[model samples]
Target: MTLVLVRKLLRDVRWGLFAVCLLLFVFSAFWVKIAQRVTTEIAPFFNGVAAVSKINPKLFDEVIFKGPGKVSQAVLGGAEIRFDRPDDFLSVELLHPVVVIVTALWAVSRSSGAVAGEIDRGTMELLLSQPIPRNRLILAHLIVDAVTIPALVLSIVAGTQLGLALIGPFEVDYSVLQKLDLPPMVRLPAGPPVLEVHAARQWYAVVNLAALVFALSGTTMLVSALGRNRWRAVAAAGLIVIGMFVANVIGQLWDSAAFVRPVTVFYYYQPQKIWLKENWTVDLGEAWAGGSPMVEIPVMPVLIGVGAIGYLLALRVFDRRDLPAPL
Candidate 1:
């Protein structure tokens, strides 16, 4: 019977679901196109560099081909050290603002309605009249939301892959250059290593992205359960999401407000940074940690923990709260 209600709720929220998914998919496609355009604009420079390397002779032994150098630095304005990795490229595309914000809002809307919307619409009284328990009903709503968040995340991933494929191969063959044999350096093979797209890394970033959205969804649901009405619920959840994002972004500019970052969810949910810099520390012992000391912590688990805590609290809140009388 709970499952029936869950299915019915799913049907009820179809419009919101469609709108959220469509917006995310479009943003994903749009951003990928922009990235591709940037790549195209810069591809000629790399080609010219490759040509020059042929005459330079010593360029063949250079490690530039294996890393994220000129293209990332010149085209994307990204740091070469970070963007040089395969996963960093995918992380840059998949972890866009549109995907994260929209997915979180979707969770906010669905969660806000769990108990508050029904009460405000004067339907809560009747819902409690059914044999279905309040906790089950709320859980069902969250379950539906949980399913949708991942779908939205995937849309972004697909858009990134599509963009990469559309642009064709973006590699620069360094083999055309003459080998430089400098003593011990001669041990290194004089081959033109290539730099190109890796599809697998995109999925890895997406996996972390999914965790991020899931955490935001659950946190919003918790706020929803706390509010007395749907509007209040939405506001509370929206403010937190916006606040955390703002704090994270601004923290980059100011050192004083840096303390606010750790408490905010954004501090712990950077797949791009982890994959790009190759550091996975979660203790955050020092502010932001700046990808050092190698804490070896998994971000997904912390995000999941936050989500679980939020849902449990929401369940308790809804179970104890009194439903409003129907008009």
Candidate 2:
């Protein structure tokens, strides 16, 4: 019976799922292409800058690295931007504002319709009249998430691989004569070096992204369970996601607001950090250690816990609340 409900729900959302998967796949490939262009174009310019800056130590180290570089770092989650590793460059795309918002919107759209949407459409009475238990209904929706979120993430993975294949491995171009204002025939001595993108390294961040989607969907499901209108539920969940995202960004840039990060789900959505880690393990003891979001709190587990709690609360509320009369 639950299987039937899950299948019906999947059929209803299949088109929406396909659209999202296509969008994610295209965006992922596009970002990879952008990274490749940066490698080919910007790499030489940066090389020229460093070479010329050798005449004035302050130009490279102080003016560029510490000045504008710091701002870029803060905005991109506070890690030094490493041009040498193209994988790091690719990972930056995953953390882009567009990617974050799209994934959150997917969650908001799906979860918001679970309960509140039915009630809003005067279909909750009809749905409940079926033998499907309320818990199973929610479970079926969760099952939908389990299927769809991976399709979205895997689309990104496939797109990235496709882009990487198109670009081939990184090769440094020392042909800096045209890009810089150096004396007529001067050529660059060295170019940036990079390793091919590894499947495992990318998976680390992919898992983090999945965990983020899970957290958002689960949290929004609670909101959906509480409201009667799907749009209101969407607005509420969307606001929460935007608020947390803003807080996370601000917290990165400001010391005073640093305290607010851990409480926001975005704090755990560190794709770059996870990509750079040498090892992965979960430690509950460090969940809130040092009152900073920098602590290693086992990203997947913490996020899953947040989602679990939200679902449990939604279940409890959903079971007890009475439905309004059909409009």
Pairs that collide in candidate 2 are: none
User: By summed lDDT, which 10 consecutive residues of candidate 2 come out lowest?
Assistant: 282-291
The candidate that wins on lDDT is 2
lDDT of 2 by residue, 1-327 (tens): 889989988998899889888888889888887887666656555656666555532344355547557656665655465654577788787787777878888999999999999899898898889988899888998899899989888988888888878878766555554555667566555644554666457777888898899899999999999999999999999999989988877776666776677788887777887777644443322233443334446677878888888888889889889889996
List all candidate RMSDs to the true structure.
7.4, 3.4
**How much lDDT does each candidate structure score?**
0.63, 0.78
Evaluate residue 226 in candidate 2 and report its C-alpha lDDT on the 0 to 100 scale: 97
**Top model by TM-score, which number?**
2
Query: TM-score, each model?
Result: 0.76, 0.88
RMSD of 1: 7.4
